[model samples]
Target: MFFRIINRIQPCTSQQRLLSRSPALQNSLLQQFFDDEENFGKQELRAKKRPGRSWTNEELRLKSSEDLHKLWYVCLKERNMLLTMEKAHKATARHFPNPERLDRVKGTLKNIEEVVHERNDAYYQLETGDSASAPKRTVTSFMGFTYEKRAEEHYSPPGEGQKGYEVPYLDDDAYLMQKLWNEKELCKERDRKDNLARRQLANDEMKHYKRGGRRTFDRLEDLKVYQ
Candidate 1:
C-alpha cells in the first residue's frame, strides 16, 4: 500500500516543469500554501468558532489519558491559531481581538501539565530508585558567595576563557586599589556638598533668629504677654 502511494507521486510533468522553471510561479504557490494554512487554522480555532467557557477541573479529572493528549494538541493548535491571527493583524494594520483567550488557554495547558507531572512523579517514585527530578547544587563565584544552582547541558562543550563569552572578576591588588581610591574621592565630594548645604541652612536659620530678635514689640498687650 505504501509502495502504491509512493508510485503515485509522479516525476515533474511538462506543466509542472514549466511552473517549477519559473521561480516566481514556484514561490507564489509556496506562499499561497503558507498563507492559506495560516488563515484556515486561525479561522478554525477562533473563540467564536470553538465557543465555550474555560475547561473545568471536573472535565480534566474525568478525561482519559488519551483525551488529555488530544487536549494538549488542541491547546497547541489554539496557540498557533492566536499567533497566526496576531501576525495577520499586524500585517493588515488591525487589532487582534480577544488576546486574553490565548492566555486563558495557556493557563489551562499549564494546569494540565501540572496534573500530568504529579502522576508521573508518583509513578516514578513508586517504581524507580530515585525521584525523576532536576539535580541541584551549591556553587560559589569569584566574589565568594555560595548559592543553590542548576546544571545545563550543552550540545557542544563551551570554550573556556573566551572573550565576551565569559568575563572573570578582577580581584588583583591594582584593581582593588583603584576601586578604593575612586570610592574615597566620591565620598569626599559628597561630604563637601553636604557640609556646604548644612552651613547654608544654619546661616539662614541664624539670620531668621536675629531678625526675630530685632522685631519691635509695639503693643503693650504683647509686652504684658512676654512678661
Candidate 2:
C-alpha cells in the first residue's frame, strides 16, 4: 500500500529530513491528518500504476449503491491526504509534484456524487413521479439577472405569526420598470446574436482571400460559386 507512495517521493537538499519522529508517535490516531512521515520533504510525487483517467459515469452506474458509498469515502480520504501533503510542500517551499492527481481524485468524487444523484432521481421518479432534488423556481432580481430560488424547509407556514417571512412581490412602479428593463435586455441579446452572425459571415468571405486580397478563381464562371 505504501510502496506506491514511497516510490514517488525523491529526496533532495535544503529541506529538513522527515524520518526523525519517535516510534511512539506512530501510534498517534491523528497521523492520518498528515501524510506518511516518510513522504514529507520529498522532491516529487507521482501516482503508482499511473491511473490514466478518472472514473467514468457508465462504469460507476453499474456499481451497487453500497460500492459507491465506499468509493466516495476512499476518494475523500485520498483528497484529504493529497491536500495535507500539498500544505506540507508549501510550508517547506517545495513544489507540490503531480498536482493533477489531486484533480483526478476530485473528479472521481464528483462523478460518484453525480452517479448517486442520478440513481436517487431515477428511484424517486419511479416511486413518486418527481425528482429527489429540491424544488426551485426562477426569479429575476431587481438588477435583471435571473436566478433559481430553491425551496427551503420551514417548521411553520409563512403567514400570521411569522414576522420575518413574507411572500415577495414587486410594487406597480417597480414591476413596470423591471418589465421595461427585461424588454431592453432581450433586444440587446438579439442584437448581440445578430452582430456575431454578421461577423462570422464576413470572416467566411475573407478566409479564402489570397495575398492580393482576392480569392482564387480558375475562370469567371467560378465566381458564380459564391452566388
Per-candidate TM equals 0.45, 0.61
**Model 1 agreement with the true structure over 20-59: per-residue lDDT tens digits:** 3444424663333222221232324554444455576666
Error of 1 at 58 (Å): 6.2
RMSD of each: 15.8, 8.0
Alpha-carbon RMSD, candidate 2: 8.0
Instruction: Show the colliding residue pairs in model 2.
Output: none
Clashes of 2: 0
Candidate 1's error at 182, in angstroms? 19
Clashes of 1: 0
- TM-score of the candidate numbered 1? 0.45
CA lDDT, every model vs. true structure: 0.55, 0.67
Q: Which candidate is the best by lDDT?
A: 2
